[model samples]
Every structure is written in C-alpha cells, then in structure tokens.
Target: MQFQTFSSPHTDRPNSVDKVMLQVILALLPGVLAMTWYFGPGVLINIVIATLSAVAFEALVLKLRKRPVMPTLHDLSAVVTAILFAIAVPPLLPWWLTVIGMAFAIIMVKQLYGGLGYNPFNPAMAAYVLLLISWPIPMTSWLPPAVLSTNPLDFMQIVSAIFTGSPPTGLEWDAITMATPLDGMRTNLDQGQMISEISQSPVWGDFGGLGWEWVGNWFLMGGLWLIYKRTITWHIPLAFFAGLTGLAMITFLFDPESYPFALFHVFSGGAILGAFFIATDPVTACTTRKGQLIYGVAIGMLVYIIRTWGGYPDAVAFAVLLLNMAAPTIDYYTRPQVFGHGDNHG
Candidate 1:
C-alpha cells in the first residue's frame, strides 16, 4: 500500500499566460497565411521584424527596470502584440517604422504600464494609431492584392522595398499600389459615386473585394476556432457584429444608394478581426459578461459611424482604444453583488 503524495496546498491547474498566447498565435495562422497568399512575402517579413524587435524592446525595458528579462520575454505576450501590429501595418512598411511601432508597443504601451495584464489599452492598437497618425503616407500605401496587381514583387524585391523604398527596376510606386477595399469604397462614395457603380470595379467580389473578403473569411474561421477552444467567449464578437450589421442595415434600408449592405460591412474591413481579437483583449476589455456586450456594442457602433463619416478609412484601432478607456466604468457598474451580503441574505 502506497500513501498518496500531493504537493503543498494541493491544487491543479491547466492553463497559463504562455499557453493562451501560444493558442492565440496558432489561431492567427489561417489569417496570416491568407494574407501571405493574397498580399505576398512582405506580410511575413513584417511579422518577423516586429516580433524580433518586440522581444528586444521588452527585454531592454525589463533590464532598465531591473527586472528578470528572460521570464518576461518567455511569456510571449510581446510577441502577440508584435504580430498584431505587423498585420495592421502596410505590408511594404519600412523597417524603421516597424521597429518604432514595436518599440512603442512594448516599451510605452506595455512594459511601462507594469507589463502584460496591467496595461489599460491594447498595446498593438496603440502602436498602430501612433504610426498611422505620424506617417500617414507610408502607412496608407497598401499594395494591391496579388490578383489585382499587374506585377507583384518577389521576395527579394519586397525586402528591398521595405529597406530602400525601391521597387523593381521596371515598376514604379504608382503601378504597384492600390487602395484597400475599405479605403477605395470610402473614396468612391465621397466622390458622389453610388454603391452600385462602385461595386462594378475590378476590386469587387461576392461580398467585399476580390481577395480581401476571403482573408476576412479566414479570420472569421480562426475567431470561431478560438471560441470553440474556449479561449474567448462569443458575447463580444456576437454583440459587435450585431451592432455593426444592425446599423448598416438601417442605413441601407433608408437609402440604398448612399449606404452599402450589412454583409459587405461585416466582410469588408477589420470588423471581424477587431471584434474577435482587439476588443476581446483580456487586459483592456470588460470582464463581466454583461459589460463585455456593452463594450463590444460600443466598438461596433463607433466603427460604423467613424468609417461612414470620419476621416479615417478603418476605425477599429480607434474604437478599441476608446472603449478600452470606458471598460473600467462599464465593469464597475456591472460588477455582480456579493452573495449573502449587501441586503441579499443567504
């Protein structure tokens, strides 16, 4: 007969920060690969540069703060931020901009706020907003999808473009780049063009745009997988889509020529990604179940309002950051009362 032996305190747990972040990285794969297939190797290059720089910056910040750098870097939260910021930027973004974004994300938005769980806002989105505001031209210069592009650059050319701002000898900047689907739609609509006329453009697809809609689909699949795995609940994403499509439908029904359909709004921009990834951030998002819905709904409504009328083409980053500021208030009001206390007797 052997006596059972258990560790002190006798507790067992199955999840960790590293594990959750790793799962998120896995969930991001389908979308990342779709971007690569549609855009080119610059996507991967940006990820690499951002990830490496994020680790380096995090380590530097930790060392300056006299903390154990290896342990902090091992958790891989910085890597997640890096990857998110990478995908958010233009594929052909310069190397320095990539470095600056990662550094700002890790050093300013993350580590300086006591690292990881203590940050009040999503680090990646903050960094993206900074870059977008500071370098509007480079940030907005998105390459046309491979299908739309007449001359897609090879890997070496992409590297060269990132480092040197030089396209291949035969091609110039104007020839290789085109507006993203969302940006193009906004531009056309503002120029007195109707949705019907714009839909006939070469960029149009069944839902959003030729290659872009497929990428959004893959991201949706990945988000569903995260929900299935219990990494994230469905409340935020569901509320987000509901709020977005609800408004889009209302507007479209009121004036079909002025507003696009709801599904097109769902599939066109960063709506799905923001709903699933950015808005659901554990550190910055609302924790209470009811509060999460409110948070998500606010983000959704702001997204539609901003993209429709605001100067920016994509408003996901801005919306998430704004709601991040409001999450604490939402949580405070929605916090459940303690059982057997506060007049609710046991």
Candidate 2:
C-alpha cells in the first residue's frame, strides 16, 4: 500500500484587508462626530461628497483598466482615503473642489500607481496638497469653532455656502471664516511675532484652539484603540511623538520666547492623527521595526521643521509623502537578518 500525503488544516482568522479598513473607518467616527458638532453640517456634506466621488472614480478607473471592480470597491480603501481627505480639507470649500480632489486621489494617486499596495504616496495627503495648491482661498477658509462662532451654520446654509460660495441668508463667507491655530501661528511668526505672544492670542487656548484640542484628543484615543486592537503597531506613533517632542523641547530650551513648548507641538494641528493613523498606513510606510522608527522620526522632524521654518503651517502631508518616497530604501536597510544567516564582521 502507498503512503498517503498528509495536509495540515487551514488556519481560520476573521482578519482581511477590508476588515482592517472598516475598523479604521469606525475608529474615525468619534473624530468625525466631534468635527461635525463643532464645525457644523458642512463637514458632513464634505464627507459625503468626497466619499462618493472617490468610490465612483475608483470604480471608473478599475473598469477602464479592465480589472474586477466589485472586489476592489468592497475593500473600502477608497472610502477611507476619501474620508481622510475630507477631514483634512476645509469643510466650507466648494463642492467641486472636493470632487476634484477625491477624483485625483482615487484615479491618479491610488489607481494609476496600480492601486492600494502599489501606491508610493498617501492618497489623502496627495489629494489635500493638490487642493491646497489649486485653491488657496477656499482651502484656508476654515470656520471658527462652534464655541467661538456668533452664528453657527445650519445644514441647508452649509450646502448653500459650499455650492454657491455664500450662505442662504447672504452672509459673507469671510465673516464666519477664521484662520486656524496653525495658520495663525504661521502668519504671526512670519510677521516677526514671538511664540509667547502668539500663544497668548485669543486664537489659542491653554492647550490649543477652542474645540480642536478635544478633537485631537479624541483621535488620539481612537489611535490607542487601534493599537490595542493590533491593527497597527506602536513603533511609528511612539517614535513620531518622541521626535516631535524632542525637537520642540530642544528649541524651547534654547529660545523659549521664539519656540512653542513640546506639549503644544504634540497637541496641535494634525500631529495626533498623523502619528497614529497616517504614518501607520501599512501600504506606503516602512515594514520593518527599525525602519518604522526611523521613518516616523524622520516624518516628525520634517513636520517640526516645516511648521517652524517652512512656509506651510502644518507639514504632516508633505512629511508623510517625502518619507513615503524613502520607505522602500528604509525597509531594505533596516530588515533583520534571517536566523540561519551568518553575521559578517567587517
């Protein structure tokens, strides 16, 4: 009798790319809710427009490329990219701007590069940068936080403002619009105001702006949840914060009058979200442990540098894209040697 070949049983797990993407989308809900509560219905409208546009563009591109559309659309990558793009952009921006940005993100950045795992840049960041460059006024026109707004916009007013560039009541967009904390800081610094003076302004509260600090903290909590769920590792977040804090501390020590404190850097702008969610993106980020640390630290340092010295008020998008370009090289250099490989002493 011939001996029969033995086969091991397949390991069962509930994890999939789609499931991971869904979890991330769920995690962003709290932050999105906070934004809507503070920023008004405009944010929700932006989300809807961007998400639908991204999905549509993704499907169109896939069909044009002769790829299976159903499976790819079900992956939820385009949805996540769109949501991130919407969150980063000004809620009151023109509806067409959102459509254009999402289309570029899905068609040019994500799909043109061969889709999800093949893209070398963060799709959302790429789209955000494109919009910012193309529409400076709209991109920068952020509404004052609800706590500070004299007249908070309703849903219809928001829709009208976005589509017509004016509220239904004929209110001027600039009256409701105000510079964000980071934008204020950048402008003040450019005007030769010291950090201490800028920090004392009405625009900045103890930690950050009126409602922004809370939003950032909520995102931080969600990020911690993502780590607890093992959807992302801790290396990138920890290293990113470490680099930011370290750099800020060094500058603050040297010139407290000119530089903001470490805590401000950690709590302000997109630092929390960038560290936890954006940098932790598995596709464009480095894979090895050491490479993750290095990549994160590099991003953090670049963010600080650009915010402090460069023209941009926030540098998360630029930093992430720059580091994304280096991820492959970082991974190769930082990969751990195989167990059986002999260590070569130089």
Candidate 3:
C-alpha cells in the first residue's frame, strides 16, 4: 500500500487571508465608531477615500505586473492597509494626499518588495511615515474633539474640507485644528510646563486626553476581542504595554512633576492600537513566541524613548518600522529546538 507524504509542519487550519482581513476590519469597527462620534463624519470619509484609492492603486499595480487582480483584491489586504493609513492621518487631510499615500502603500511598500505576506515592513506604517515626513503640516493637523471644537464641521462641511483644503466659509484651519494629545504633551513639556498643570487643560482626561483615552479604550476592547477570537496572540500586546508602562513608571517615580503617570502612556496616542493591531502583523512581526515578546518589548521601549526625546510626538510608526528591520534576526535567534534535533534530546 502507498501512503501520501506531507510536509514537516502540517495542520488543518481553516483560516484564509480574506477571513483574517475580515476579522481585523470587524475588530476595528468599535474604535472607528468612537472616533467618528468624537471627531465627526471625517473619520468615515477618510475610510471611504482610502478604501477606494487603495483598491484602485493595487489593481493598477497588479495589472502592470500581469498578476491575477481579482483574487488578490478579494483578500481585502489592500482595504485593511487603507483603513489603517486613513485612521492614522488627520481626518481632514486633503483627498489628493490620501490617494498619494495609498499609491505608495500599495505599490511601493507592499507590492514592490512583494505582495502582502511577502513584505517585510508594515505598509500602512511605511506610508504613514512617508506622508508625515513629506508633508508635516497637513499630517500633524488634527482637530479638537467635538466636545471641545469651537465650530465643529458637519458632514457636508467635512467633505468640503477634505476635498478643498479649507474649512467652512468663516472658519480658518486654526479654528478647527489642534495638536494631538501626544503632541500637546510634548509641546507643553518642552516649554517648562508641569505635567500636573498640563493635565488641567480641558482636553485632558483621567489618564490621557478627554476623547483620546476613550478611543484607546474602545481599541483596547477590540484588541481583546481579536485575542479571544484567536485572530492575534496576547504576547505582543501584553509585552508592549508592560514595557511602555514599566519605563513610564520608573521615570514618573523619579520626578512626578515632570513625567505623567504610567497609565497616561498606556491610554495616549496609538499605544493601544499599535500594541494589538500594528505590532501583531504576522508577516512583519516575529513568529516565535519568545521572539514576539522580545519584539514587543523592544517596540514599546523605542516608542517611549522616541516620543519622549525624538522630534515626533507619537512614535508607533517609527518604532514598528525600526523593529520590522530586526524581526528576522529576532526569529533567527529565538527559533525553538526541533523535537528530535537537539543534542540533549538525541
């Protein structure tokens, strides 16, 4: 009798690329809704604009490469990348820049190296960094949450602003735009303001910023859901939070007036989102369990260091990209011993 031979690592897994991407989209919805509530319809508009442009750019690239377009498009990887980039940028970022970002994300960062699973870096983050460095003003111009906005734009006004690069008839960009929580903290800290005094501002919350911490909470819930669903493991997120808060605690204890509380770091600017969503990108992240912990911790530490000292306010994109370059080396050293290959086992 003849029997079929299989590969060394074999299992019957039901998950597919499309299915995984779908779950990620579902996981992001709660956080997206919260952002919309606090920031207005611009969040949704960004998603729509990003989605359309990413699909188009990806299809164009695939056609140029003579690959099957529909199958790749069906996987929804482009859409996921698009959504991430959209949410990371200013809500009222001009439409053309969004298109440019998607083009770079899909074509240069994703497809140029190889598609999807083959790429070593996170496409969304690479594109985000590119846009940020290329156009600092628009990229950093975030708006005050609805509760604090002097004149919040309605749906029509938002659409106009995104397309036209101008707010409503009377309002200037300064009237609607304000620095992000992380930006505000960095700016105030640099100008000789105490953490306690900064926290007294209306935008400040119990931990982070008023609307920002809640957004982080929603993303945290979504991330936990992803873990429960087996869409992601807990190693990265846990290690990330541990590393970030651990460092924050050390500095905060030394000088309470200078450093914000540990939880402030946890609840601020992309920390929660980066921990679960971006850092956990299977393709770009370390695969071995031990490697993942190391990768997560390193990223967390880098984020704190860069945000505290570097020019950028939020350091998620920078930290993740930096570690992406190191993930292969991490995996190499952390690879587990084979069942029958180790000297002791033999």
Q: How do all the candidates rank in terms of TM-score, highest first?
A: 3, 1, 2
lDDT (Cα, tens digit) per residue for candidate 3, span 199-307: 9999998999889889999999999999999999999999998889889899999999888898988898999999999999999999999999999999999999988
The 0-to-1 C-alpha lDDT of every candidate, in the order given, reads 0.90, 0.88, 0.92
Error of 1 at 190 (Å): 1.0
Candidates' RMSD to native: 3.0, 3.4, 2.5
Model 1 weakest 10-residue run by lDDT: 1-10
Each candidate's clash count:
0, 0, 0
**Poorest 10 consecutive residues of model 3 by lDDT?**
1-10
Q: What is the lDDT of candidate 2?
A: 0.88
Pairs that clash in candidate 1: none
The prediction achieving the highest lDDT against the true structure is 3
Candidate 2 residues lying further than 4 Å off, grouped into runs, are 1-10, 167-169, 343-346
* Candidate 3 Cα errors over 4 Å, as ranges: 1-15, 343-346
- Give per-residue CA lDDT, model 2, range 227-306, as digits (tens): 99999999999999988888989998999877888878777788998998899999999999999999999999999998
Candidate 1 residue lDDT tens string, 160-229 = 9999877778888888888878899999998999999999988899879788898898889989999999
